[model samples]
Target: MAEDGRERLGIVAGGGGLPMIVANAAIEKGMEPVFARFSDGMTNDSIIGRSRAFAWGRTGDAIEWLKAEGVQKLVFCGTISSRPDFRSILPSFKTLKRLPRALRIVKGGDDRLLRNLSRYLESEGFDLLPVQAVAPELLAPEGVLTARTPTAEESAALDLAHRAATALGVLDAGQAVIASNERIIAMEGIEGTRAMMRRVAEYRAARKIGRGERLALVKAVKPGQDRRFDLPSIGVQTIDEAEAAGITAIGVSAGESLILGFDDVIDRANTAGLAVCGLGGEQGTAR
Candidate 1:
């Protein structure tokens, strides 16, 4: 709690800008933001307010740090570039006590891992908050957000991409898929959406094709995913990457995905003459 007695939110920072964005948003809503950084070394030191860094296996330490900071609500945000090296994890007494459950988390896919992690944290007494709950305004509303609405072909491509994303989600593989010429060309993996975009760009350049109106990328939440962690998110960076990948339009699950820096994302998409739409339907519905 703050000196003013307001609750403080503990943000588990990862590799992207979303963590900071969430932290700032929490502050605007009168909640103090405390950070818990991981040993992956991806989270930068540009964070505001109090923070503590811990190794992947040091769950007990992290919980202690959050408790000390008076954080009762916690949210996980941003991208994780790599998985932890289990061999390198220095076992603390706390970690060893929870080894079996921790193993279950690390051994699963991204969605499973996060779901288990959220459950574990909540079991330990912290209120796990989802990104949408933390910042409702950041949720992408259903509509065309760009200066130009998607062309019929682009919209069709988006539909195809959405289906592909759903399958990807069901597999607990990833949240994004790129579609062009009525087919999915790529799906996001552990490397993340930006890396998948780069791969699409490479494929297009290599083939010297598919750089037209039918290309679209759709990002959506995995079916039955725990909303408290690893929600699909996009920002101005997503716009820039999609543009670079020769993607004609972008579709995101409405209310299920987070749009970091919403205005900046729209402006970037408009400037690039790219269509950005928040898709709504069975797949895009919020949990």
Candidate 2:
């Protein structure tokens, strides 16, 4: 807590706009935001003043810095594009004791890895908060968001994509899938959503299909996923990628996925004539 009685929030930032978005929201809510920036992660420059940089393997250093900053609540946002190189680990005495467990966590599948990592962090005496807990405005709302509601065929495709995405998530595999012409063409893997979309684009192009063909991109939270972190997210860039990949519609689990720049995402999808909707309980309202 600060002298003003506001909690100091620690953001473990990686690549993308999300860390900055969370920081801005924390500030608005009267929290002091401190950053633990990964050296290889693409942290935005705007928050540099309050950030301390640490390498992926320097767990001890990062935690020590956050503690020194008086942060008790930590939230993780953005993407860690690749796994850390265990060979490069530089452990201090404090973390060295837990090094073996950390290695095993890294060896597990994505969901199991995150669940264990959350426990590991909690063991370090800090409370973990999910992104939506700090910034509920970022959560995607239910119902169609764009001017173009999905066609009946496109809606059916969206349902197929969602089912495919859930299957991928159940395996701790990935969160997004592209279904085209009633068939699953791609399921995100370690390559991620952007790469998967690019692959879809290339596949379509190879078959001599032009832009704006029929397809849907759907993302969902893994069944029994730890909601404390790593919720699947989409943004304006998602719309751009979908358009590029010839996807005509996009669906995400309502209140279960983040839609960064929500209005902009809707506007972009509308302008592109793509259908965007959230699939789940009809309880959320558009922000």
Candidate 3:
């Protein structure tokens, strides 16, 4: 992505361990990592040393700062709770210059807006790197990841959940769902996956749906999902939430989702007696 030596990569941080993981990987490979934290997204206390926090609405400010810092490439990572509060960001001169396009972007869906941002940054001479390039180790692999495999019934439930998640993803609705006996019980909304799982737990208790292999949670990449931001991710917390939700199995599209602390996620799933499988492969490649 570099045309010269000015190739320091910036991690456009949101919230989560992802930015840290990517930052470490970039550092290990001897790439300079500038953390450009988003105010609307999650940030860890550990970020103070290397990060410059910015607002999501201050796109121009972020870009101008990156350019000044000699960052020629950027990998957008982590999550924002939702859209930025546009009313709060005082537009920089640069942002005002692109106000029309920026306004259009703010009016679009999240994926569309992110893709537009990537294009806008690239058009401004900065390279946009996919998360995979920075942290291939986090990519989910094909087949079962945990020791436990899906029971026959759960496998069927998995397929159902997968299809449901796919349809939801196509609409850019959300990434995950909790399904039981072929019925969709919960979908990740603005509340997110963990909260959705907790809601499922409440439902099971109220509906008298006893814990067993009767439920499965599935995560799928959106059709033509933008790789720059909001990639589906699972972790030890995911396992814990699933267990709490009476979910006995989990499925994610292979290569499309990330397993943070990959080993720990699998180990936790195994310990919880939950099946975690990465599904989908096309032409012998993880997809």
- Point out the higher-scoring one by TM-score: 1 or 2: 1
lDDT of 1 by residue, 1-287 (tens): 88888779999999888888888889889898899998668897687777888998788888888988888999888777788776789899888888888888777898778878878888989998887787889888987887898877787888888988888788988888998746778887877888889988898889745445368889988887887777788898888888888997898888888888888899888999988988886643211
Between candidates 2 and 3, the lDDT winner:
2
lDDT of 2: 0.83
Cα lDDT tens digits for candidate 2, 30-65:
898889988774776666547898876677778888
Q: State residue 266's C-alpha deviation in candidate 3, in Å.
A: 1.1
Q: Which has the higher TM-score value, candidate number 1 or candidate number 3?
A: 1
- Each model's lDDT comes to 0.83, 0.83, 0.79
- Cα displacement (angstroms), candidate 2, residue 98, comes to 2.8
Rank list by TM-score: 1, 2, 3
**Which residue ranges in model 3 land beyond 4 Å of their true spot?**
1-7, 208-213, 281-287
Using TM-score as the measure, the top candidate is 1
Which scores greater on lDDT, model 1 or model 3? Answer: 1
After superposition, the stretches of candidate 1 with alpha carbons farther than 4 Å from their true spots are 211-213, 283-287
| Candidate 2 collision pairs | none
